[model samples]
Target: MLRYGDYTLSDDLITKITAVARHDDLVPSFVICQLCHETALGQHPNSISAREDNNWSGMTWGYDDLDPKTRKSGVQVTPGRKRPAVEGGYYIHYATVEDFLKDYGYLLRNGGFYKTSGAKTLWDHARGLFRLGGAQYDYAGDGSNSEKVFNSYYTSMKTIHDALNADGSLDRIDKGESSNMAGLQSLFSIARQYLNEQMYGSGHRRIVDTYNGQNPLPVGYKLKIDDDWCAAFVTAMSILSGNYALTGGECGVERFVRDVFQKKGIWLGKVRPQAGDIIIFDWDANYWADHIGYVESVSGDTVYTIEGNSGSPSAVRRQSYTWNMWQIKGYDRPKWDYASPAPLSVGGKSIDAIAQEVLTGARSYRIKKNTSSLFE
Candidate 1:
């Protein structure tokens, strides 16, 4: 089975699709979703478009009588006549898979579809494609009931995206051009200094003192002078190391650690090991993660870690463990948002209000084309 996020393509079609998309400058996720909707990833074994014409995107056959250069035709099949057949009418075809993608990309980019709405996310782009395809779906305002089906599509794609990301498949799929774990490198750099700092005295005092000076106390709890400083040490290091986002605003290690993984949708045993991941330990293998550390590195059969509470003095120590170590419960990889999403709130105005302001700024499309409306 081939994976594209969390969903499995169960075939090698995604490999070719990704290649074509990357080379053609089309968003891979959007194209994949369209293919999923159009042809079910070519899982319809007896599909006429898949078997006869190698077309899986349902591009329609066209002939321009006025201009010979505009003529484009495909091997047509009637609705409901064959497996994976179009329900409404005859559909288009292509000679090869590459040709299908090339034509589809060209049409999507040059046609009024992509030109109309400057969509940023894959879901929004899918909305545009749905509109262009005359699909019965609305893209306005988080999509109402008519467009609620779009949510399923978006959820599936996001599942796939997150799965692929957790499994580190995007790096391999993108030919190592993008590494999801690249953001963790800086965290390791920041944590490198305290690799072997031994805590004197009660050890908890130093940790609490260090934490208070750097940032304000977290919402609920005030730091006790002699509390177990392991969690506090981890939290302080995180804030100092520029990974404040994953801290989860919790003073406790277990709570924040769980929060990081849950919020990121990455669970233990679901993701591959990468440096700078937060490693929590279950000392007695009782399913309770009590101790936490930063993943230093992973070798072939062993994992190296830099932990805060190692000895009685409570000094940071570098430790190594084999994969079968019972104390190792699991690891949580920090979710780093490299690209911020579009601002939903702008200058204290709600997104709806801002959208209205935007709509008021631009004139509505009124031009006519081929007895239909020409979108601006």
Candidate 2:
């Protein structure tokens, strides 16, 4: 709904970009902002890709992994008008704008560096622009996580993300149709659909892990990927259910609590939780929140939950806890409105939930710094 009414980039092209990027599970707005940055809103002199090839985002055709995916070898071209490919070939020439977009989406989605560069979330990508600048080009070759570099690229994207989503509205946020329980029921239902789900090294959860900029268990490893991904699952549920605006996503629980729940004023401390509240627990009663899960329902003194990274083999499963168990730290509730439940999966892809990013040590350096405010 962003009125790109002020830009010269045609609505058709922008629309195509959105459709293609989203089709591949890539965030389209970030892709659009990157295109604007690289091609000067598709008006740069070096953007012959934009003019002739319809490669509006400066995609090069040199990587071997990406080569086999495309039908053609690509057009021989140079970085600038006067320059030429060192030998005779290597810049991608699209047969159609569709071809270019398909390859572009494939590159970003499967590309080794984009996710690590923080491509999962728009602001996330700003952190590792050195690797992300141009995996082949290494645009920020100095390898500095400098504010100046971020200011240049991310600031431009910020200018475009409706002033950085100022006022905190997200794209898919739905207003309540009935009561809070209705939306909470929908959230629980969406999560319930994925119960007994296996934790695999490949699939939607693994992909979303990279998108979140968290290193996920690699495929083909000897181990069965038993890493703790509870928080990732919760975060993914938030996104898949269109509740991300209410339930902010983060890889670490400490960060989720301190940065999101607490910062957003959603951290309801030590209060009895209802269904749909995010519950935090402390196994040791040492004051740091160690585990997180969603409240399915509260029956008497027991709280049912759908937690990722639960049980013996480690998978998405349902469990119960005493409502006031010492391990039960507190709850953070999202303000929900009524709506129908979203499908647990999309296009055979989950897009966001069910991966438990490892909890290396919640009581480590991070929580040590943020513990003062919780009990206060």
Candidate 3:
């Protein structure tokens, strides 16, 4: 199966989509999501827009009269019936895939895609599509109760967007292109460092000290050696791994889910998870989440997690569970771009980041001959 973000697409559609989007100065991830929503990534069962006419996204013909001068208005053709979401007037037909992609990009930019609300994030662009997309998107086309339509559209798009972020599919698609594997590697390394440590006993000081010393946690908060550390452990590791920007900082499971994860748009509620995601467990089967941990790996239906406060005395240990494990509440999945060039609160700029800046001429370090020190 060919994959692009959370959903698998029909034959090599991602390459063409990304190429046209990048070339046309459109957001690739949003374009991918729009395509997936419109035509199921060029493979909608009852729709032959992509297969027959090279139309990926469900771009209907603008009006009865075709204007060849308009960059977006391609040849109009009567096409097969599609799902209600995309059912509309005459569909645009293209002679080639390249023609369709290029026209799609031109249509979005030159069309009525106004009011992006800064367009900083995927959700922002999605909102722009509905709110300001009267001439093209048509979400508010019918007119009455447009706010209700927007909310419903946003909720559905959020699910698609969140899944794309969680699986590292949007890793390279996001702005600045952070490395997801680098962040995962750092978490694994940190977990390995505290694997054999004891909890709540006389020997628990080391892990506690290491966490406190290493992480620049926000003021007014610090953990005791024997305190409930499951949440602390995950947050601290996130901070230390240079993912503070993505994961944020939180000490309580419920607070983290509601405040940090959901607030930042990385919380996946009751969705199938992948490795390197944070898992919450409620042993009592209550909606209140009781414990937290990060997934170590996944094999078929089983999920392996390395957790703190798991045993009788709550020491760090690896445990395995089924995919539908009863104790699981939800997940706190980080976006694939964990080590972005954006500011990381836990630590200053990393060597890799520094090197990138220098290469791009955004930064330069010079040694002071008088003081024997350097500044960038």
Poorest lDDT segment (10 consecutive residues) of candidate 1: 365-374
Model 2 per-residue lDDT tens digits across residues 324-360: 7788888886766423334433334442332122111
Error of 3 at 66 (Å): 27
Candidate 2 residue 45 C-alpha distance from true site, Å: 66
Q: If both were scored by lDDT, which would come out higher, candidate 2 or candidate 3?
A: 3
* lDDT comparing candidate 1 with the true structure: 0.52
Candidates' lDDT values, in order? 0.52, 0.56, 0.60
Model 1 clashing-pair count? 5
**Candidate 2: 10-residue stretch with minimal lDDT:** 367-376
Clashing pairs in 3: none
The TM-scores, one per candidate, come to 0.44, 0.40, 0.47
Minimum summed lDDT over a 10-residue window in model 3 is located at 365-374
Best by lDDT: 3
Best by TM-score: 3
lDDT of 1 by residue, 111-174 (tens): 4334312345666665564543343334323344535665666676666556555765544543
Q: Please say which candidate is ahead in TM-score: 1 or 2.
A: 1
- Sequence-dependent TM-score of model 1: 0.44
